[model samples]
Target: MAAPNDVQISIPKNDIEEQGFKDFDYSQRAQWLRAAVLGANDGLVTIASLMIGIGAVNEDARAMVLTGFAGLVAGACSMAIGEFVSVYSQLEIEVAQMKREKRVGERGEKEEEREKEQLPNPMQAAMASALAFSLGAMVPLLAAAFIVDHKVRLGVVVGAVSLALVVFGWVGAVLGGTHVVRSCARVLVGGWMAMAITFGLTKLIGSSGMQL
Candidate 1:
């Protein structure tokens, strides 16, 4: 029998679970986590899709290996360079814009005294943007490396990459408080365009009697 003066208290287990879930989501880390997942996924899809398309034309194992290897090298380097340049360019634009805005703000400080002023911090903005862009681009290329078969590998990588791009774009839009559907659509469309162009070019080169 419990004493009359004693009190019993119970805490729901779900309360902690809910709290943890909330903590794990909607943070800066969320973006990075999403980036890594999407990047790896993109790499896989891109390579896979490329390989499949190549296989459709011919079933030579040597050709497939050559194609896959070329893709791996070309894709990885392209991703790295693209990531660096895109990030660099984005940082430059952001810095330039911020500086311009800051200059204007300073010139009109007296008139805009009532409004809050945002001073441009070029260093911080550049660093953050560069880091984000590099990491985002690296994800897909890394995922493509795991595939073994040359042609099939390329095909799988392409498909995975395309899917990853859309997923990442959606994730980015959500984080930025924009339309998820539009962002995802843009990525998908862009990926398809890239695939088409690449396939077309490869076909042209092959038909031109260029030995791989």
Candidate 2:
């Protein structure tokens, strides 16, 4: 017979894994996490869409590659700058809060050092975002690099982008402790939507006899 005061508890496998990874404190990485995952995803989607959009009107592989390369460079720079500014602002706010709390005086050097160690790093965030953007942007570029055929090139680019989207979404979901299927589906669908809209719009405009 079971004791009346006893209660049963169940811990899921995923929960156990998550708990194991909790040693480092996920909240501390929020700033850099956005820099890496979101930046990479943005780069992948933006450059792929640009290439697809350009490919719609012009079948030339050179044009698509050039546009993608340009977008990747510009996007990477923009992402780095934006991430740096955002993280720097966050760091400033947190530091200000610490000062307001007089944590420095009360906690002494060790505590102050610990607080500093926990602070978000702007340079690190900026670099992570830039590198991540470049990595994501390269997927479509590489896929279309060697293929000269117009239709085939476009198809390959789309396929590569789709795969990259799913991968990025899955990685992000895992890191953020979210539902893998939902995240993958969400990003995959969004990427498809963006590319489809861009391609359709560009094709429609090209068909209208507009000199683009």
Give the top-scoring candidate (TM-score).
2
Which stretch of 10 consecutive residues in model 1 shows the poorest summed lDDT? Answer: 114-123
Quantify all predictions' global Cα lDDT against the true fold. 0.57, 0.89
For each candidate, give its TM-score against the true structure: 0.48, 0.84
Model 2 RMSD vs true structure: 4.4
Candidate 2: Cα lDDT at 77: 97
Cand. 1 Cα-lDDT:
0.57
State each model's C-alpha RMSD to the native. 8.8, 4.4
Tens-place lDDT per residue, model 1, 70-175, is 6555655555455546556765775586667777765566535523433333344434444444444444445445655655555555666676777677777767
lDDT of 2 by residue, 1-212 (tens): 78999888998999998778866566666777778888888988999999999998888888999999999999999999998998899889988877866844676785567576768889999999999999999999999999989999999999999999999999888887779999999999999999999999999999999765
Which residue ranges in model 2 land beyond 4 Å of their true spot?
1-24, 103-117
